[model samples]
Target: MSGRLSMCTICPGENEQIDAVIKIGRERRSVIYGTVIDENRDPVADAVVKLLQVCDNGRIIPLTHTFTDKYGQFLLGPLCPNQKYMLKIYKDNITIRYDPIDAECSDGDCIGNKCKRHDSGCK
Candidate 1:
C-alpha cells in the first residue's frame, strides 16, 4: 500500500515528452511574404503599407500600417484568428499605389503577401 501511494504521488521528469507535447500543441507560428518592388521588380524601400481586417459585412476596417524597410519588406499580424484581411502598398514617387491584396488564411492565423503577421496578434 505504501509503495503504491509513493508511486502515485511521484512526478515524472519536467523536461520529458510532456513538455514537448505541450509545446507542439501550442499555436504554430504564422508567416507572410515580405517584399515590394518597382515595375522592374527591384526592391522599393521606404514604401508604406496598410493592413486591414475584413469583416463578415465586407467592410475594410484598418488594423495597422507599416513602412517597408530598405529591402522593401513589411510584416502585419498576429491578427484576428480565422479572419480574412487585406493589404495595400503605397509608394510616393517610384510607382502608382497598389490595390489592397487579399490575405490568405490558414489555421487560426493570416499572412500578408510581402508582409509578416504580428508576433502576438493571435488570441
Candidate 2:
C-alpha cells in the first residue's frame, strides 16, 4: 500500500502556536460631539441646532439635527468619513453660532488578537 502524509491546517502539529488574522470591514460612520457655547464662551443649555458639513468650495451640506443637553453637550450621529463640519446654532429667531471643525471615522474596531497594548499607545 502507498500513502501520502500531510499536516492539518487548523492544528500546527501540536508543537508550535499559530496566529490567525480575520479582516473586518468597518462601517464608515462617526459621531460629532462637543460642548455648546455662546459668544461669551459660556455653556449654553437647551440650544436647538443643526450640524452642517462644509465643503472646500464654500458649500454647506445639512448633516443632522439635534439639541444641546443640560450640560451644553450635543451629539450628532453617523457622519461620513473625511468631512468638515460646522454647527449652526440658532437663538432669538436667527443663526447665532457657528463652529467649524474637521472630522473622521474611527480607523478600526478594538477587538480580538490585535488588542495587545504596548507603550506605543495601542492598548
Candidate 3:
C-alpha cells in the first residue's frame, strides 16, 4: 500500500457504449476519412477534399481544403467537435457522401485540438 496504484479502466459496460465512451469530448469530433475513388472505384491521388462551413441559416462558406494521398486516402479533420460542415471533393467531381465527423471520438486516438476555422471566403 506504500505506492499509490489505481487502474481506471473506463468501459461503457457494453458494446453499444464502446463508441460512445471512446468519443468522450464536450463536442464529438467530425472525422471524415475515405478514399478518393473514380467512376470505376479506383483510387485517385491528389484529389481535393474541401471542408466548407455552414452558417446558422444553412449557408455554405468556403473553408480550408486538402489533397488525398497516393492511396487516395484523406483525413478531413480533427474538426470542430459536434459541429456541422459540408464536405466536398474536387478536381474530378468526387462527391463526398459521408457523415460529418469531429475531433472527439476516441479514447486514445491522436487528433488535433486546434480550431482551424478560417474566416476567409465568407459571404
Candidate 4:
C-alpha cells in the first residue's frame, strides 16, 4: 500500500482535510508485440492480428485481436505466462498463422514481449 497527504498540519487547508488511501499490488501480466510487413518489408497498415490459445485437447480458442497501425505495429497482452499462444495476421485477403509461441520466460514473474520485430514504430 502507498499514498500521500497533500498538506502539512501547519497548512490552513489541513484542518478540514479529507482522507485518501492507496493500495498497490503486483499485477502479473505480459504482452505480445509484433509488426506486419510484406515480402519487401513494407508496413501493412490496418492489418488484422489475432491471438489464439490452444488447449491440451487440441481445441483452439480465440483470445483477442488488434490491428496494425500505419507503421504495421500491433500489441496484445497482459496474458498468462504459463499459456501458449499463436499469432494470426490478415491483410490483402490473406491470412498467415504463426507457430505457437510460448509465453513463458526465464523469470517466474515474467512479463513483456518475447517476440519482437524491428521497424520504425518499434523504436
Candidate 5:
C-alpha cells in the first residue's frame, strides 16, 4: 500500500504538491500458539491470553489478545519477528506472565523450543 499528500498550508493561493512515496514492504511475521493448563495439567477454557511487546524503556505495549478454546488452546499471530514479546495469561483470578517469548521461530509453535516453561501454570 502507498499514499500521497498535497496541501497549501503556508499560502492560500499557492498549492504545493509534495511527492511522498510510502513504500510498505512485506515484513515477515510469525504466530505464537500454545495451550493453557492449570496446576493439575488440565485445560483451562476461556482464559484470557494477551501478547505484549517489551520495549527497551521497560514499557509494555499490548499487541493482541485472545481467549482459550475449550481445549485450552490459544493462538496470537501476525507478529513482527524482529520485536520482543511476552505472554500474559489470566485465569481463575490469577495472572501468569511468561517473558522473552521467541516469535521468530520457523513454525511459531510454542509447544517446542519457542516457549519456555515458567513456574506459573502454562503448557
Candidate 6:
C-alpha cells in the first residue's frame, strides 16, 4: 500500500471496506564507465566526456557530462537500458567522437578506448 506503487484501482461497495495493494517491478538501469587514453596509451587526465542522445529528427540532446579523474577514468550512468548513445571526449584542444554505443543492463563494466581514430571498442 506504500512505496513506489505502479497502479491502484478502487471500487465502490455498499457498507463494505476493503484494502488493495498493487506492486510493480523495476528494471535495472545501465551505466557507462571507462578510461580515456591517448595515442601512447597513457591516461589522459582532466578530459571532458559528454553523453549525447540523438533524436530521429536529427536533434542531439546532451544527457550528461563528466570529467576524467587523475587516472583518466570517468563514469556516466543510470541511463535507460537497451538505448543508444554517443560519447564525445575532449582533451588538449582535440575532440574525439565515438560511434553510437548500445547500453545494456548488466553488472559488467563496459571498457572503451579513446584513441586518435576514435574507436570506442563498444558494440
Q: Output the better candidate (2/6) by TM-score.
A: 6
lDDT of 6 by residue, 20-98 (tens): 6656776467778899999999999999999998777888899989999999999887787667789999988768998
Provide the TM-score for each candidate, comma-separated: 0.52, 0.45, 0.49, 0.54, 0.52, 0.52
lDDT of candidate model 5 versus the reference = 0.77
lDDT of each residue in 24-120, candidate 5, tens digit only: 5454677788999999999999999999999989999988899999999987877767788999999777688979974542423365556554544
Model 2 lDDT tens row, 26-64 = 556777778878779888888878988899999998877
lDDT of 2 at 115: 47
Candidate lDDT (C-alpha), each:
0.69, 0.72, 0.71, 0.75, 0.77, 0.80
CA RMSD per model (angstroms): 20.2, 25.9, 20.3, 20.4, 17.9, 19.4
Q: Is candidate 2 or candidate 5 better by TM-score?
A: 5
Model 1 residue 12 CA deviation in Å: 26
Q: Which ten residues in a row have the lowest lDDT in candidate 3?
A: 1-10
Best by lDDT: 6
Candidate 2 error regions (>4 Å): 1-27, 38-42, 93-123
**3 or 5: which has the higher lDDT?**
5
TM-score, candidate number 6: 0.52
Q: Cα RMSD (Å) between model 4 and the true structure?
A: 20.4
**Span of ten consecutive residues with least summed lDDT in model 1:** 1-10
Error of 2 at 5 (Å): 48
Judged by TM-score, which candidate is best? Answer: 4
